[model samples]
Target chain A: EPEVTQTPSHQVTQMGQEVILRCVPISNHLYFYWYRQILGQKVEFLVSFYNNEISEKSEIFDDQFSVERPDGSNFTLKIRSTKLEDSAMYFCASRPPGLATFTGELFFGEGSRLTVL
Target chain B: EDQVTQSPEALRLQEGESSSLNCSYTVSGLRGLFWYRQDPGKGPEFLFTLYSAGEEKEKERLKATLTKKESFLHITAPKPEDSATYLCAVLVAGGGADGLTFGKGTHLIIQP
Candidate 1:
């Protein structure tokens, strides 16, 4: 089965540095999303992208965060000036549009673990 | 804010034992409730999505049921491979995009 893929399985960065996590969603899916899980916490939604623009974002998605699908196939999340609190496991996900399927199942990638020192 | 609460933070059961996991939520409008399984160092794998109060779905030894304010994931005759953190999430109606609000998750361990 086709699955979403992510790069830099683990990334260690210093405070005030920049880091970009990349993901390649399923080939045919249109809607894409970014979520993060802090150590021992629930998964939190960061943002959703479609049609080359952001549809919605959570409060946690601050000015320091941004997402792009620059190449149509690659979706990237850039965190500017990482902080200690920014250390977490970031996951990329995707789902198809429309109501054709009975369940709107979303597929997720293995996730990129970001550790800020 | 849409919120979800799952009961029994951790559970350890012998293989072939049966039990149920609970997910309670408070949301503005419910689009759907979803159940996922996550292992260490991996992302969540989809399990079931219950769209309405009376809707239920089953796969293998897992069964999920939904209601207005809560949902339950039942595991019957479980095995050691069934050990994982079970996560429950919700899609709110007229909420931000298709983002899902998730619960803290219940960590389950099945031992032989």
Candidate 2:
């Protein structure tokens, strides 16, 4: 089965530096999302994208965070200034929403682990 | 406010043992309920989707059952490979963007 794929499985960056995490969602998926999991914590939603614009975002997705579909296949999450609290596993997910059978079924990528120093 | 709560923060089962994990939620207009499995250092893998009360789905030795306010994941004759964190999430209609709120998860360790 086709799955979402992310690059840079692990990243270590200095606090205050900019970082961009990349994801290639399933080719045919129409809705894209980003989530984060702090160590030993529940996964938290970050943002959702569709039709080339941000559909919604959580409070955690504040001024420092942004997402873009720079091209047909790549969905990127950019953090303008990293913080210690930002260190976590970031996941990318996609789904073909609106279809009867596909509703609520999200395919997720392996995730990118970010460590801020 | 919408929330997903899972019980038994951790579990230990011997090979061939059977057990059930619980997930309780309080949300308005539940669109769907989902179950996922997560191994250490990896993202969650989708398992089942339950759309209504009294619905059930199964795969291999795992079964997921849903109701109006809770869901259960039952594992029968579990093996060491069944050791992982089980996560439950709820998609509430008009709750927020992307429609999901997940529990902290239940960590299961099956011993051989």
Chain B alone, TM-score of each model? 0.97, 0.96
**Residue B13 alpha-carbon offset, candidate 2, angstroms:** 0.1
Candidate 2's docking class is medium
The DockQ assigned to candidate 1 is 0.70
In model 2, which runs have C-alpha deviations exceeding 4 angstroms?
A97-102
lDDT tens digits, residues A9-29, model 2? 999999999999999999988
Compared with the real two-chain complex, what DockQ does model 2 have? 0.65
Q: Which candidate is the best by TM-score?
A: 1
Candidates 1 onward: DockQ, in order: 0.70, 0.65
Residue A68, candidate 1: Cα error in Å is 0.6
Model 2's chain B yields a TM-score of 0.96
For model 2, how does the per-residue alpha-carbon lDDT over B1-112 read when each residue is reduced to its tens digit? 8989999999999999999999999997788899999999787888999999999999999999998889999999999999999999988776444646899999999999
- Candidate-wise lDDT, in order: 0.93, 0.91
After best superposition, candidate 2 residue B41: deviation in angstroms? 1.6
In candidate 1, the residue pairs with backbone N, CA or C atoms under 3 Å apart (3 or more residues apart, or in different chains) clash, namely none
